[model samples]
Target chain A: MVNKFSIKNLDMYYGDFQALINVNMEILDKEITALIGPSGCGKSTFLRTLNRMNDLIEGVRVEGEILLDGENIYKDIDVTKLRTRIGMVFQKPNPFPMSVYDNVAYGPRAHGIKKKAELDEIVEKSLRRAAIWDEVKDRIKKNALSLSGGQQQRICIARALAVDPEVLLMDEPTSALDPISTLKVEDLAEELKKDITIIIVTHNMQQAARISDKTAFFLNGELIEFDETDIIFSVPKDKRTEDYITGRFG
Target chain B: MKKKINFKEGLIYGIIGVATLFTIGILVFILGFIFSKGLPHLDSHFLTSQFDSTSAYVDVKLSEGTENPLGLILGEMTLKEKGSIEKQVIVVKDIEKTSLAESAVNNKGQNLAISKNDIINRIEGENVEGKSVDEVNQILNSINADKVTLRITKQGGGIFPMLMTTLMMIGLALLFSVPIGVLAAIYLVEYAKPGRFVNLVRFATESLAGIPSIIYGLFGMILFVMTLNFGYSLLAGALTLSIILLPVIIRQTEESLKAVPDSYREASFGLGANKIYTISRVIIPTAMPGIVVAIILSIGRIVGESAALLLTAGTAAKIPSSLFESGSTLTVKAYTLAKEEANIELASAIGSVIIIIILILNALSKLLSRKITKI
Candidate 1:
């Protein structure tokens, strides 16, 4: 629960095509780590591997040691439990055709939280932690779809937190929203890092630099560089990282 | 000067427009004639009645104070063959017009009592001297509607029972078609490996859809009715409807499943849920509107069917007590009324009922789907 994910020699393939190769990294305990790369450069692929999500695809094969808290996840992990522990928020807000309160409580219910009072407390606390409680408190029973895009996204973040996961994975969570919504998610992510370790896959280099403590740059399924956020942006060791950050070539 | 313009294109455009209009006009004319010929029979009794096709019964009262008045023909037959005297029959004023047996007693509740002069008058009335046989026959066959009326009533059945049967049949069919169709679609979208077997399964599903309803009905009869000893039951009718609806359900559900963007599935799986859970919770709910539309179309087809139910479900106009009972549906009633008695009015009334039912069902489905698909 305290220690975070450690991935080593991770390889992923879609049939004969290689999508990620030799991905090695450690997500620090209770810290925000940013995965930065161009589109289709395997940063999102790396984020997905933490939850063993790629296994759902036909003809997908993985060879990797993805450990959560010193336990090898790929060897004997119950993926449902693994996923509930490492909760994820998606690129677009995917609230259930349900009330905002129910949307936040879904993960906990799936994990067998049946008492209404317990679920109510969890929903409230999670929404408050996501910094969206005040805006949505009066209308929790209304449909989540009626909310603004940013509020919906925050509700989804609240949904992820309602299960009390040790880690939260965000795969370009603000990519589908407007700038204002993105700013809200960025601020929420900044606050969430106080208690939970956050792994974010982002295309925006400036957002990664502004938010995360550690930053890892990837190029063509390979990790080009990994360093502290300030060093990765200001004094990176690799030329590819510098080129990608400066928008020279993808 | 006019001939210098593009006459060929103008002629082609005029011809195409004329052809399209003509085609539409022909369809409208055919429908209009059939409906107009059929629509007038719409009434409460017409809707509620059935055709016995056996006989016409009328009680002939000797009308007013002329003692022992003569029976007469109305000459009101629609079939006008000028020379035929085939339907000519002498009838006594003391009997019902439906049966050939003359009564031994009259309406005064007295026995046949004829005086010598009365017998002589009857003997003279029987002769057709100086008259054509057909003319004389017309005179003898007419009956006054005020004194006696002959209306066609069903032997032992009406259309209401059949209306209930068909509704239940369609409901069961929808129940059968929806869940399996959705699951098959989910498998195709979320689970099936791309291969020869998968392609063959998809092709089979499509082929099942194209099979005619009559063929499905026959199969249902053989499999569910005769072989299984269901004996013209609602289950058999429902089974036939389900087979007919299967292709429709699968095709629509598959299209809807495909319509849901792949990103949603990826989003769900990324949350660590399995493929099954993702499909049931996310993919299916997202594609539900199309599935509901498909179900509505299937229900329409099932409700409008006649030929299929005729063979499998039987044409007995009885209330079904159970799924095993032979029952007639509204479509079957229409067919029976229109053909057996040539009663177009009752047929139209039935048609109108069927149309209203289908419209209500489709509207209800659309409303429910809209509610669910509120986003």
Candidate 2:
């Protein structure tokens, strides 16, 4: 299987604080890869470096290469164009205070798709893909912020999908959700991997085991182990990974 | 300790209540005073007519030879043919015939002219021309019956033109300020890297907000009116007022833009939106309430603006035919009436209108913001 993103010897720094150190990983295409770690373990930072989102923070620096489909993102890719191909869903859903249809259409609109019929089709298809079309179709003209938290999150997912990205990066996408919403999002991730690669950062080990095909465990700014999810859960590679999985210590 | 804390809280609450009452009391007092002074004088005709009682028409007839010679003032007596029974109100202008009266005595020394002041006050209400000798004396002898030499002047002096001028100045000032102020705020908040120069710019804006408006008026008079040769015009006043409004709008817009969460910007950028697109689409719409408040403040300043406009925009109480012509806003008109003419009742009437305008503007802002935000 081809890797969608291959990071080699990656290190990230915030001013004098080194947040990620000598990280190397290969994210396979069309599969759900989960990053699991305790608090302050640099899993979120590692995820951000893949899409160059850390570039927004002042005094932040990155070393080494992250290649998206064989091209170094730092050197060759335009940040805006790169983001379009690798859309992100944040930890807390951030929907623009616009209509539901507009929130879904925002990405395609940003990419210069102006025809109404085409945008309508894109919005419908994206909402369906996000598993929210039936719940919202009647009132797509209503403000997206008026919806429930779970629905808003789904709409945000639809928004990310509208741009037709090949890779979807989710940063603890269900951490803020209730149990039912979390399960729904887990089911969504499982269903979504057939079309596009998904990389998720989650604190719930059970969640990682249930939905992810591959799991990478991070400890103290370092990737301790990367393997099939079952093997990571059942078998042991390193002591810290074993400790983290069994809830012995993190 | 709990009892003591309760006493302190009660004391603070009492202070707050007193302060609120004081503010409300002042507002009620001013409104009551203005209404009492201005309500009786405020009527439709006073509000609708022009500032001056315009002279429309006068009855002048060429007088025959007389010893005083005040009546021989016209070269020709071509009466604008009207039916003897016709009665109509005509707009009277200048009623002078002295120049024509001089040329009437052509080479021969014959009294063929009527003097300019020999106005025949033809009473149109009754047939005084065909009156019997006794009846004519009775009409003249009676103090108020069949009066001759009617100088029928129309009721004049209205505040309508001043209201129009006030509206025009407000429109022009808002046009000049809003776009420039919003753009400047966007640049300062989003684009400019934080440093000493940016700090200096912010400091200058704050300082400008504190300077007295009279200073701004003087500066505007020197720069826009005299230096730029705009003269005492609505354009010059608006331009000056725009400068005064800039610091206010820029500060408000900047604060509103800053209030937009960083997460929104991140989301927009994460979705492939450029900086300009994110600011225009997401940020500005979210910050609209604060911007609207800024605009409302600017309007209040423009409407109540007297000191600045009096110097820059002259107090000519005519409906300006062009932007370059001078005009007076409501505050200026009231000020002129009160200070120069000492017409307190009329000034109070203008004051009442201004208060009503401010209320309408505030209500309009509320309606508009509610419509846009749906909140």
Candidate 3:
């Protein structure tokens, strides 16, 4: 399998406090890679560094190389262009206070797609791909925030997909969702990895085992173990990974 | 524990009720006072007509004289002061006016066999019989072949012009201040790094807000009016008011911008939007309510502003022909009318109109904000 992202000796700091320490991982193209960890385990931090979303924080120091398609994203790539290629969905659903149609078209519009017919086609296609077209086609002009939490999250996924990104990063996207919504998102992620690379940070180990092909276990800013999901779930090399997986201590 | 909580809750509820009632009562009393005093004087004529302080109409009686009474009034008449009545004796000028006055004499059916001096003497008589003021004015109006030019002094020049000036000043002030203030706020909230200079700037903004409006008036007088040679113009007043409103707008806009969730910014950025695009598209739309509140507050301040305008935009009650000309706003006109003319009713009428305008503005902005939030 071709590698979409290659990280080497990654370290991240907020002011003087270290959040991510010497993390190395390869995320494969057209595959689902799940990062699972306990609370404050830096799994989400590692997810943010992929698209350089961490640059918004004040006094943030990063010492690492994050390469996307053989180009060092941290050094050579323009952050805005890099973000276009790597999309993100936060844990909590945050739809812009706008119409559902506008929300889906926001990304395309931002990148200078001004034609109405073009936007309409893109909105329909993206919403269809995000699996929300049937649920929302009639009320596409309605406010995005007026929808239910699950539907709004799906709309956000549609919004992110409207830009046609190469990679999608979801940071505990299902944590705020109900069980049904969580299953729907899991299924969506499973289907989406056929076309785009996805790196998800999840606390639900069973969810990680169910959807992800490869899983990386992190503990206290350290990558404890990384292997195929079945191996990590059944016979992990590290005791900590095994303990976390078996529900002894998370 | 439940009983103790009930007593505390009752106390708090009582306090809140009293506070709310006190606020409502004061508002009712002020509205009642203005309406009662102002409603009677708020006619269309009072709102539209123009008058000057220099001229007045006086009633004069004519005594019976022997022979032809030379009945003609002309320009440049000399008046002798009487008890609240000024009797003016005039010589004849302009043959057309002489003919008009002759018709008045014929209408009264009096014998006109007198000289101009005799006419003057007759007009000065104490116990003379003559037409009433209204009757004379009617006769003068009809016979003149021109029009009645009653120089009614001590009348208000209407509030319409002052209202226009007030609106214009507000528009100009908002135009000048909103952009600068919002941009400055954006810089402070979105772009500025935490440092000593940013802290100092914040402190300066706070201090500017705390400064009295009178001080702003003084500064405006010196800087805009005198040094800039604006000469108490509308532009000067708008510039001065913009400075006064700047700190408030900046602070409120900053607060509103800060109130926008970090998640929205992240979402916008994650879509490959740059800082400017994200701020314009996401952050500003969400913070629009608070920004509008700031603008409305600034408008309220501008509308009620008198002292600052009196110093910067001189108390000329006439409509300004251009932005560079001097004019009085509604509040300044109210102050001038109340103090100089001592016409409390006219001032109250102006105050009432101002209140109505502000109420409309507030309601419109609220409706607009509601629409924005709904979208």
B1-375: candidate 1 lDDT, tens digit per residue: 677567977899899999999999997885676567655655554444443322233333454544323333222222212375333222222322432223323344543322111111111124333344366445434534334322211222236577668778877878887888777777877678889978998999988877777888788888988998888888888888777877888888888788777766765554555666677777787787888888888888888888788878887776688888888888888888889967676677677677667779889777866755554
True-vs-predicted CA distance for residue B363, candidate 2, Å: 4.2
Candidate 2 lDDT tens digits, A1-250:
8989999999989999999989999989999999998999999999888778888888899998899999999999999999999989999989998899989888898889999999999999999999999999999999998998888889999999999999999999998899998888889888889999999999999999999999999988999899999999999688889989999877
Model 2 chain A: weakest 10-residue lDDT segment is A49-58
Clashing pairs in 3: B67-B113, B68-B112, B68-B113, B68-B114, B69-B112, B69-B113, B69-B114
Ten-residue segment with the worst summed lDDT in candidate 3 chain B?
B144-153
Higher-DockQ candidate of 1 and 2 = 2
Clashing pairs in 1: B41-B345, B72-B142, B73-B139, B73-B141, B73-B142, B74-B142
Per-residue accuracy of model 1 over A82-181 as CA lDDT, tens digit each:
8878888888888876689877877776666789999999999999999999999999999898998889889889988887888999999998899999
**Model 3 alpha-carbon drift over 4 Å, by segment:** B1-27, B51-157, B361-375
Question: Candidates sorted by DockQ, descending order?
Answer: 2, 3, 1
Clashes of 3: 7
Winner on lDDT (1 vs 3): 3
Model-by-model lDDT, in order? 0.74, 0.82, 0.82
Per-candidate TM-score against the hidden true structure: 0.78, 0.82, 0.82
- lDDT per residue (tens digit) for residues A81-185 in model 3: 999999999999999998999999999999999999999999999999999999999999999989989999999999999999999999999989999998988
Model 3 chain A scores worst on lDDT over the 10 consecutive residues at A241-250
Per-residue lDDT tens digits of candidate 3, residues B1-375?
Answer: 999999999999999999999999999999989878988878775666553322233232232341212234333344444355655433333333233332232223443332222222223123212334343333443432232222212333467678778889999999999999999999999999989989998999999999988899999999999999999999999999999999999998998898888999999999999989999999998999889988988998899898889999998877789888999899998899899978788788888888887898788778866755554
